[model samples]
Target chain A: MIEKIFVGSKKYWFWVFSLMALVGIGLCFYLEQFQYGLGITGMSRDVSWGLYIGQFTFFVGVAASAVMVVLPYYLHNHKAFGRITILGEFLAIASVVVCLLFILVDLGQPARFLNIILYPSPNSVMFWDMIALNGYLFLNLLIGWTNLSAEYKGLSHPAWLKPFIYISIPWAISIHTVTAFIYAGLPGRHFWLTAIMAARFLASAFSSGPALLVLLALIMRRFSKFDPGKEAIFGLSKIITYAMIANVFFLGLELFTCFYSGIPAHCHSFEYLYGGGRLTMIMWLSALLACLSLILLINPKTRNNTGWLTLSCCSVFASLWIEKGFGLVVGGFIPNPLGKITEYWPSLPEVFIALGVWAIGLLILTGLYKIAAEVKSQESNAA
Target chain B: MNRRDFLKIAGVGMVSTIFEPVLPYEIKPSKKRLALLIDITKPFDIKACLDACNKAHNIPEIEDPKHKIKWIWPERFSDVFSEQIDMPKEITIPVLCNHCENPPCVRVCPTKATFKRKDGIVMMDYHRCIGCRFCMAACPYGARSFNWIDPKPFIKGSNPKFPTRTKGVVEKCNFCAERLDKRESPACVEPSNGSLIFGYLSEMKDLISNRYCLRRKPDLGTSPSVYYLI
Candidate 1:
């Protein structure tokens, strides 16, 4: 099974090498960031977290979305998802890798990261988040590898693997919930101190995760002998549609709560995001893209068509990436605790480090996917 | 016993032993809760207090406002009390860490790097901090500052007695715990011309009892130790 990744087409090797090259460039910039300090990044005392944290938040959602497929396929016995489940699990492994790397890059003292485990404070949401994310990563790796190995051997997956698969469903939900608690549990930062934050995170995660999965499945169809089945893709699009709708509705709820109540502390962050602040343009663009994607997804005619579906999926992924990834994290810090607005923009080194992390994730995804595709193709040829 | 069961029992025992010390100990009610009261009504040299704090802590003089490390500074009355519409805009108030009794920073630190002492003062262990900035995000008051770069180059003259922070750790006013340990008043308090009052909350009751002192965002329930005498 491991050998399958080594044997790939020239194009596959090119893709692998390109991602590696990006990882190399990113590593060089990261070294510079290490030598200097987090000062090299655009973050200030007012806005302490920036691109690194935002990316970490976004990828946590991506990683948790694996449960969307796992739940339906395993518990509900949705056979259509069986072919795509491995893809979801593999994507989760890659996304969690990215999430952990983002956290590492964002840390002021990367070497002291072990302190979180050494001097564990269960009172902190960060402590629980560390447990949830690492546990999920481990679960995905164990379950994914065991199942894939069994498949490659043309044997039924072990009976013992059943309990682990079931546990993964709730564990997936926990990862995103704990991540949301990191923000929602904070005393200040009105933008994040909402009870509904976890719900909103799950909604966006479900939408963005499935949207990316659909795009990857389409890419696999075009580039490889393995076909993930049209029914599986259709099922995922339907999930994306409902999740995006929920995500938009949750955003609307936040708007109504902030504006209708008319509290300055509560409304200032939204005012900065949608009104005259620096993020105004980007925020509006995300909203526009969300609406556009919804319009395309809601209609069955466009939803079924590959071209329109691809366009809508791209819109969904981009919209949530901006809304949840960039806007949400930065918006929380805009009106600093003292009613002062301090804007944040990532420096060049920060951007490269983030890009490098993404490349590492994609490289991992490429290798894992390459192995799964080979197994699926071999099974098909045998049949 | 089976190997699995034995392993589980061993794990539980080890975990309990590790966490036994971490469990909350009884805090003596008689222990002093140190507090500070800033009398805005009195005329104090704000610049002198700020200078004293910087020199005492060996805080860097970074030119970039974004990366500036400050333990204490003066802020406009209007900006600090934005909720108070009737407040005078021209008046400047000295602001620093409130040393909240129920510190959100202590709650959010993953490694227990920032913790609330039994005496109701929040403390930071610089060596243990992972620099996640969770404490900065959690704090209601913009008091905490991270060492964004190597501060040694920016310090005009280093204070040998005090530890100058390296880059990548969050730091803030320790309520001059070091000075308190030496039985000396805080650097800022000494130069504040009696404007900044420092004492136990119980002992300072006479000063705050008669005056209408306000705590920053008192409604948030952090129970800030710093009070403002208007």
Candidate 2:
């Protein structure tokens, strides 16, 4: 199946080469970081985690979004999703891979990475996150592989896959919930201490993850024999619309509480993010894009048109990328624990390393999608 | 004859070595749980105390305040305890790790690298830390400092007793755990000349009871052992 990925159009090879080029550049930067310690990056004592951990948080949501496909198909028996569930599972695998790579690159002592496993502390949220993420990865691999191979073999999915599928539904929710707990459980961080944190994480993950998946489906329709069905795209749009709405509602709730309480600590991060700080432009842009996306998606007439739907999905993804990936982590540390302000911007090496991780994820996603497309094409031709 | 003679020599050597007993390494526990009492009410010279801590800990004198590492230093009373009422102006309160009974850093550390000792002193095992800096975020006091760059080059006249931290690991005031092992008071305590009290909390209860003492954000429930006498 993987061999078929190699026999592709020149554009496929070019894409592969471009990702390879990025990986090469990233490796060079990573080597420099390794030699000089984490000093090469833009992080300081004030803002301990910068771009890498922020990306780690974002992709955890992306990895967890496979639930949108999994729940409807497995639980509700939505036949429309049967064709594209494999794409969601593969996206999860790629996103989880990127999430893990982000963590690895962010580690100051990469050599001692195994200490997390060797001396596991049940008390730390990071410990549980490690378990949830790796467990989700394993479940996806097993479920996706067995089901796909069964389809390729032209047989019904094995009965044993039933329990695994059921387990994965909750497993997907747990991964992002635990990731949220990683920040939310800390006492000093006013920005992440909210009770609705896990809820917001899930809502944003569902919107962002599926938006990317939908865009990928549109891309697949253009390049491959797989149509992913008109109904399947519409089904996913409905999920994105509701989740994005819930996500925005959650943001509003946070703002109302922070401002109404008049507590300086509670209001500080929000003010820094939107009140003429470094992230002000990105935060406002995210708000504008999300509002635009919501307006487009909520209207049934606009959503029906594939062109409008595609644009809406892209907007939601970009909006969440700014909200979660760029501002969320950095904002939490602003007016740091001691009431001192320190700003952070990624260095060139940091940017390269992050790009490299994304390129690696995309490369894996491309390969996996290639195999899935090949199998789908064969099944259609045989029919 | 040659084989018998070698065998006899080897057997005697083994017997002789077995009779030579090895000496036991004694591990004595330090005096009862230690605490620090900073008497902010007194007019103590803070510079000497800060110098003593810097000298004792081998802390680097990095000129850039952003990257500078502090083990113990003077902070303004208004800056740290803004909520306090009737506190005197122009008084400097020394700030260091609270070494809390319930340490947030110890709880969040994934590798158990930062741990609280039996005597209620929070200690860091540098070798075990993966440099995640999660502990830094968990600490409410802003007590911890990370070596953002190699801390060695900036350090002047390094102390051989205390090991200089490498870049990436977190370090803070250990309450001079090494000094305690040798049955000496913390470096800052000695320099303060009765202004800073270092003793078992049980032993110093009378002194603390007489003073209007406060710990930073006692409501947060970290149960910090370091108390400031106002």
Retained true contacts (fraction), each candidate: 0.80, 0.53
**In model 1 chain A, where is the ten-residue run with the lowest total lDDT?**
A117-126
Residue A42's lDDT in candidate 2: 84
Residue B85, candidate 2: alpha-carbon lDDT: 62
Candidate with top lDDT is 1
Q: Residue A163 error for model 1, in Å?
A: 0.6
What's the lDDT for all of these models? Answer: 0.92, 0.88
Per-model B-chain TM-score: 0.89, 0.84
Expressed as tens digits, the lDDT of each residue in A6-105 for candidate 2 is 8989988999999999999999999999888787888887788889999999999999999999999999999999999999999999999999999999
Clash pairs of candidate 2? none
Instruction: Supply the global lDDT for candidate 2.
Output: 0.88
Using Cα atoms, each model's DockQ against the true complex is 0.66, 0.27
On DockQ, the candidate that comes out on top is 1
lDDT of 1 by residue, B114-230 (tens): 887877778899999999999999999899999899889999877899998889999999999999999999899999999998989999999999998888888788889999998
